[model samples]
Target chain A: MHDARYGWSSVHRCPSRHSDGERPRPARPGGGLTVPTIETRGLTKSFGDVDAVLDLDLTIEAGEVFGFLGPNGAGKSTTINLLLDYIRPTSGSVEVFGMDAQRHPAKIRERVGVLPEGYGFDDPLTGREYLDWAIGTKDADDDPAALLDLVSLTDDAGRMAADYSKGMQQRLAFAMALVDDPDLLILDEPSTGLDPNGVRTMRENVADVAADGTTVFFSSHHLAEVEAVCDRVGVMNEGELVAVDSIDGLRDTVGGHAAIELECATPPTELGVEALDGVVDVAVEDHTLTVTCVDPGRKIDVVTHVAERADVVDILSTTVSLETLFNELTEGGREGGGETTAEVAQ
Target chain B: MSIDSVLSKDLTSVRRSGALWGVAVCLTMLATMVAYVNIGRGAPPLREAQDAYGLLAGLVGVLVPIVAIVASYMSITGERASGGIKFLLAFPNTRRDVFAGKLLSRLAVVGVIVLFMFVAATAITVAKYGVLPVGVAVGVFAVSLVYAWAFVALSVAFSSATASRSQAIAAAVGSYFLLVILNLTFRFSQVVRLVYDTILGLGENPHLYAAADYVSPYIAYQKAANLVYPAAMERQVFRLPEEARETLPVYLTDEFSLVVFAAWLVVPLALGYLRFQRSDLQ
Candidate 1:
């Protein structure tokens, strides 16, 4: 609080817009030896009368890749804006690297790199030219050619940015953000619009950057990509974070649930024989039955019994994917009686 | 972080056109020779000829604002349209730096052009007639550049606030004609009356008339190009008309116009910079 390396004078004191400012920043997991790279307490933002992000709390540690999971318009971009200080928040407080973001935005930005949701760049300049202009401000002279190689855009460095494909533009955007060699990289859907190979390259580059002690904060709708790349994941829905944990932590938090899928000759009247002791919910459509259960260990026994009772052609049981876990955590409407698709689908 | 950075960055970016300078210099020289030919056609002495030529070149004043508008119309808008403002503003420098840097560079360019015309006009007048008074010629040259600086600043400021290049150019040119013609006659009647009264006071001796006219910086810049040596400035040559002399103390005393011209540089520039700084690029 009394450090000169980062200080907040009286001019920097932000008014507490809501109860959000009072929410404690989350400490990192395990022994918490590492300092947090990004933290927020009850951070909220509203545009006109609509709330974009509401009472959100998140913490990401140094050198850890964290994925912010949310569907479009579910406040993913809004939260990024708040974190980056692109827009002022209506309530709550955001802290990046333990420094109040509003007070020290320039300093925070000096250490933080961002790839916005859109692949927005100034046209009329070649990719090489634009990178030179961007990297000029930072202290180091970054090699534009090397950056192009990292993002797999080395072959197209001389082309005007306006002519680049959406995936190629996304690659350029990532390269631009990383040009400064920032300590933290915020990538909002970095792999958006990319082919499978592009996505693989993106993941590899993100991993490479994180390996160099840069904390990678990325948001994506592809839950599997998030699970594969992120050491921790935070699930967001309806302007709020529903859960924040490691992939396995989220898997454990949503643990004991398995999806039992079966292909049948006809719609069953009742899945009595298939109703395993641990099954929580069941869905029957066409000739398929999807059973949600607390313990998948009993799924094979239940399927065998169902096969004995009905003309079941094929049956399968597998651990729930990250997509399923995300649906389970974020499903259901805000409070009360509106059942969510996750509830129905589960 | 430093003014030098802003200056160097701007200088580095702008594409200089050698052809523009070549064309501008040739045109100035041609205009000077034409004015000399008129003098050769049995026109009055160096004094009368200077006034006539000065009046013609003072017309450039009407277009000076327009030139400013055209030169600067795309300074900010071009950068904004190309998504360059964000990259530029991301630096620690303020908008003030951008405004100042751009204005200075424009003024420097205009200064060179004004100097070329002034030199050509003086050379032609000396060639047509005998040597003119050195004081009057030097004063005219200095004052013309100042006026050019003022117009350039005015145009650049308008350019910075405008959304498009065409709009900025239109506003600058339109405002120039309005201020020089309609606004002086209609909106500011008092100033026009003073100007008209001053012009009529000029007698057959066009030299005195030209000298009194130089009291108006607009007329003074023209007089400099025409090589019109005002009698008031050269007391030994002729006595200034009593009325022209009376207005002399008021009109020739340019503290007020100088301040107005200075404001042209300061106010619009400040406002333009503020607008650029706060505007959202995306």
Candidate 2:
């Protein structure tokens, strides 16, 4: 019911109406606003001579699923560790919820839930007991039984934490993070060892929580998971965030906008739609017209005109996958220029 | 928000499934219950019960190090190994709170075990003699506990700095033995005495033994323990040679050495807490 209300409200609030009568809704006070949940400016960390994270500047918005997409040794974990105050940055500062994180890590952590990668809980306690102990320090309205049920660990809840499988342990960790119903959830490689269905459930759970206006900051090498769950993603390569934007915005930057696929019963002659605005390239494969457009909607009119001449059987659009987009953006190229690619100093 | 909550949680958690409490209790029972050769020959008298004070000191001497080492090693390493340190550190407690809470809990473990054993020892002494020397027994127990607490802090310092349980344990034990052996050798060996006399200029120095007292906390504790014994009172009555007098005051008569040993506890603990606050947990 709440979903419908939000859905309709979002649809009615047109982009132009964002100015005139509305004062941007007074920044939503504390909810649904783009306030920085975590902000790092000129953040640098070094272990001896090796720089793990170098001059990283990032802003993770409140209530947004912010994905830190990076490869191994790309400093995703290091950045998370810095934010958690497990390690002090060699330079610069980290702020969480508008407070200095290093100075008040404990207070910052109280409102944040973190599932650190490869974290192993004590073996003596059962799954339920471990979660209970983990959440004991926080204020919560959860019973271990309900939490176990949510994570689908009702049966295994009785078993010792050591006896849990890798996936089960991961699930239990997720349950532990959810115990406090935290405002900020920081997950480092959250879907590490899960099966396909488990991954789906994990993705759904993350999305569901983020949908309810909890800021989620997660790091993952799996671009598909990031694409599915994150509203905005920052790609980290060699300890620097190279790109930060919505998935669609990244795709457009990397793969040069969304393409409209037109399968016509009769192919148009002379590629007339190529001369149309926003149509970058046009290729006719048998009866299908594959139109690569800088603006998909602009080409939509041209495609419709062409379809009036040719009997159109199918009309489809293609957006670049997160993987292809990530590679192209990080690799650095000049095929299409729309948005400026952001680069962080090392 | 409260330090007691943190300390209470630590104590309860450590007591539940961990082996520290059980080991401490077992060692204390064995030390107090078993008859030692050092306190024997005469039976069923006030003097005999006073003789048991030295035996009780010996019991504490053997048991305190073991408990100190076990509890200290378990304090930080156990939490880190279980990944509970992250959970604990993430709460609304500062590094000072965490360090102090763990230190107090470990000390409390030793205190509880030693107190139980002291009560048992007093009961045994009462059964053998007509009455218990409640004052001496309780004072000795309290003094020994303070001394044990010094080592407990040292062990925790090592535990916080080291990466693994084995490493922490090994470091604690190695340091413990090194101090004891070095102090013992410095006291007995003529070559060492000659070296100290030549290099550190202690040949005719009156304060040579007093300066040497810095090597081990055990010496200070042992001196205090002897003072609580009735034999020590007898020693105080007899006339002694000049060297004996100087050595006796340094080891057995000075109250200031215990204060210095007590400082060792606080300094290492502060260093450990600082390191823990900044050190990466990876």
Candidate 3:
């Protein structure tokens, strides 16, 4: 919403692209909290024959950590580029902080801090110079040392970026995005080129930034990070928004079945097993009883049934990981096995 | 578009780059060495300030083009190749701002190099000949800046137009051959005449070499210099005045050299900016 202290974003106050007879004033300017940090309706982009991103609608709230996930060729980068107005959309509209992205790219960019994927740093700029340059571009007052400190690169801020390692460069990029104390942070593949420790630091930095009332909209193919950081995750497949929900909600989509694997003493019959409460599917294989149970309340009854009927040595309740849910929901080539790496790598 | 922001960023990056500084230092040394040999050496040395000025003019006319090619051949292409332009455009700049900023900053760079060489040339000529010939020094410096501007424009155009640094290099080198070498070398002039007279249906013209020279920006610079200070520079610059040059048309006159320089400055930048603005950087 609106803060008179920040003023109305007068720069992006142009008439919306599809202005009819009368203009509808946006609510964010009226001090209402309904305006999303990023919103897209029927957004589409196509490069020749390939529809990189199709009619997609998305809404990300303020102070929300929205994880945009997709398999390769799922138009994740295309969507990010569209949101940033790097390329013209084939059709539809995008808005960031109640301003149309296409109509007010510069104004949108002023308040939005972005770490675009597939971008490189100036070789001669020291880490400090890079941060200062970003500050200059945003026309915002920022201390280079504090920005570098946030990324844990304060000691190496004086060193040329050419000498910095890949992870260091990514950290520097993250720091540069914080120059203006932006209202929104769009980090595309922020954890890429990082070691395990670097990934942890990135996650912490993201968390710390989000805690300052800045909405963080990040795209990642890495499942666990999204699950850890995102309040909601959107999955795209074949140029379309295929899934959008919380991590657990997505895992619960196909009946929220809880998978329980048991080490059984003997082979179990399927007749009584299928009749058990909340059990959607059951299969016995190689001395293990696997039960897909939908209800957590009936989980104990299934264990009782198994233990009473066929000696259950051990029972394990495994929650479906976001990785598995992602693979199952998106086009991971399970049903069609002939998909090549080119199709997968898009 | 934030032109000031982009220009500052560009200048900051260029100043810190060792390669650019190295180019500047190397070009300065080369200009000074060449100036030293041209005016100070030989039995009956060309000691007149205007004469030494003409010789120094030739020295820098050749030198500035080389430096321009070297300094800007990869100006935009290298950044695009390394995916750095994406980073630049990720800020508040439009693509046009990036192009304008690059042009202004790089022109400033080449301008500094030309200034250094001209200052040193003016100093050495004044020291050796006991006169500054203030008018000639100013004319030559102004002409040299324009000369460097044309080359920088062409180089930056190629840099923005090409997809790769290697292609930019090839374009810069090829442009160097077309504009800098075609008229100076007889063979290149002969080859051009052959292509025009024998290959094309244009009737045999003995003035084809002069026609080629009129189109070349470097030749225009020399012509402009001669037109400005013809009496003093006649014995200064080494050139065989051909009949074709005397009969060269009104449009190809020394005044049109400014026109040529202006086209070289504007056309390439316009085309390059349009392409850079429209193209998908990634």
Candidate 4:
């Protein structure tokens, strides 16, 4: 029943490896079959006249780190809120561990750990106290010190969370989300206020948990981090999920191309590379000939054509980054273009 | 377990808040002043102690509701406004746990002030009069506790139903004026009687008028307080004729005031929870 446009069939589920023997596996609500860690069908939410999330259909298998990539106001947080049932869907359903999220939120939450966006800490509660509260609420036996160490907040654990800096609070919150060794972790814009070091720690923490068989659903607008850790990403734009694919698949879906900056002995005169098949654009500046192609395979063809026209000296090639793909899918691909590759792939 | 966790966490947070301490100190000072003034009126020690209890009831009946409102009106909405509730609900605790925890924690906060007020009053009365109306003091304490809880419930109900701090504040302040201040001035009962009489054409019905008067939690508290310290009966806004007082309708009796107090405690909270359970925290 999965939508082929989301590329769910190609989603690779890492082998289950329960590294922490001390943490008990949460019992799935419906016992016989392997259930998708999270599944939302036709999920939609509206705030009065505006719909914050629209017609979202997604499925994340166990042990997969699925990135929810979207720009600001792309309804990423809204979808997470719907998954946690913090906000009810306007006219759809979400399931976590094969149980209806709305009907059994507390039960579903028993196995889920969430780092919600714009979360504020209670006054005068030390970082340790916040961790203790999370542990107690989940009835988990995690050592607070270890969690603090994980987030590099060991020294700041004794300080009041209200006194913590944005980055410190983000780290503290990440530690709290790691409590009880949750079966599913949903982090929304987790790296928003973190420094480079803090961002690396978050990525490693996500990877560490995913290795222990936790299903991680991380949402972010930061492409590099999502590209670094996510097994697959679903791009959202203006409340609609525009694309979902593996990093390589996304590159391919967007007609993955490379920009070749050829440093020639002499600038090509009357170069007809633009007329070649798959050649998107060509320009010459000083002693350099730049060729943009719609396919990576066209790189060699352009170089060969250039060598015939003029003496070829050196070549540098850069492949399409996720940023370009994101802009293409969310920006130009949505407004004027009638259908994007993501739509056609369906 | 989740409820306990939420309650204890909230208690720790509320305990450190300066506002709760401010309310407590003010309440204690007021109780002590009322006790000192009433007991110093110079009468037989027994009569003076009883008189002190009556005066203390008047002081608590007005101040306890205000204290409860201030203590609880922002309990939920403040968290929601500051985004603290997202952290609170991030764990496995259900919305029910959050609501019940807030209710109980605010009750505990107000309960401490109510307990301190009675203790101070009792100490002052015992010191000055060398005698104590133990039965009346205990009964008034019980009734005042319920009165505080009733108002706390109402304020928390406002907190839960409102999506913003300003809306909750408006509801709280408006309620205080309508239920306590206006009720004290008999304006609320007068309006109730006007509507009741005009609607049902029950002209000159003293029982109906008395029943309408008891609708306010403030008046219900006085009736309940009067049951313990009969001196409070003189403060009643809608006094029936002597003959009718002896044959009062059930709804107009002191016992029925307890029912009103119970309704005040329950109905608002139920409505609040209904709204809270369905609301999107964002």
The model with the greatest TM-score is 4
Best candidate (score: DockQ): 4
Question: What stretches of model 2 exceed 4 Å from their correct place?
Answer: A1-35, A257-320, A328-346, B2-9, B35-39, B184-195, B200-202, B231-252
CAPRI level of candidate 4: medium
TM-score of each: 0.66, 0.80, 0.81, 0.87
Ranking by DockQ: 4, 3, 2, 1
Put down candidate 2 lDDT per residue, A280-323, tens digits, no spaces: 55667888787665555666676677866777788887864556
Docking class of 3: acceptable
Per-residue lDDT tens digits for candidate 1, residues B134-153, read 65567656666676776676
Lowest lDDT sum, 10 consecutive residues, model 4 chain A, at A1-10
Model 1 global lDDT (CA atoms, 0 to 1): 0.63
Sorted on TM-score, best first, the list reads: 4, 3, 2, 1
Q: What is the TM-score of chain B in candidate 1?
A: 0.67
Query: Candidate 1: DockQ?
Result: 0.11
Which of candidates 2 and 4 reaches a greater lDDT? Answer: 4
Task: Give lDDT tens digits, candidate 3, residues A59-81.
Answer: 88766678899877889999988
Q: Which pairs clash inside model 1? A: B50-B226, B50-B228, B54-B222, B211-B230
Per-residue error for B105 in candidate 1, Å, reads 5.9
Q: State in Å the error of residue B250, model 1.
A: 8.9
lDDT of each: 0.63, 0.71, 0.75, 0.83
Decide which is better by TM-score, 3 or 4: 4
Q: Write the per-residue lDDT of candidate 2 for residues B102-220, one digit (tens) a residue.
A: 88888888777777777777767777666777768777887878888888888888777776778876887787776555545444233445667877775744344444554467666
Every candidate's CA RMSD: 10.4, 7.6, 7.5, 5.8
Q: What is the Å distance of residue B43 in model 2 from its true position?
A: 6.7
Candidate 3 segments exceeding 4 Å error: A1-27, A31-35, A46-48, A90-92, A98-103, A195-197, A260-319, A331-346, B39-47, B186-192, B200-202, B206-209, B232-248
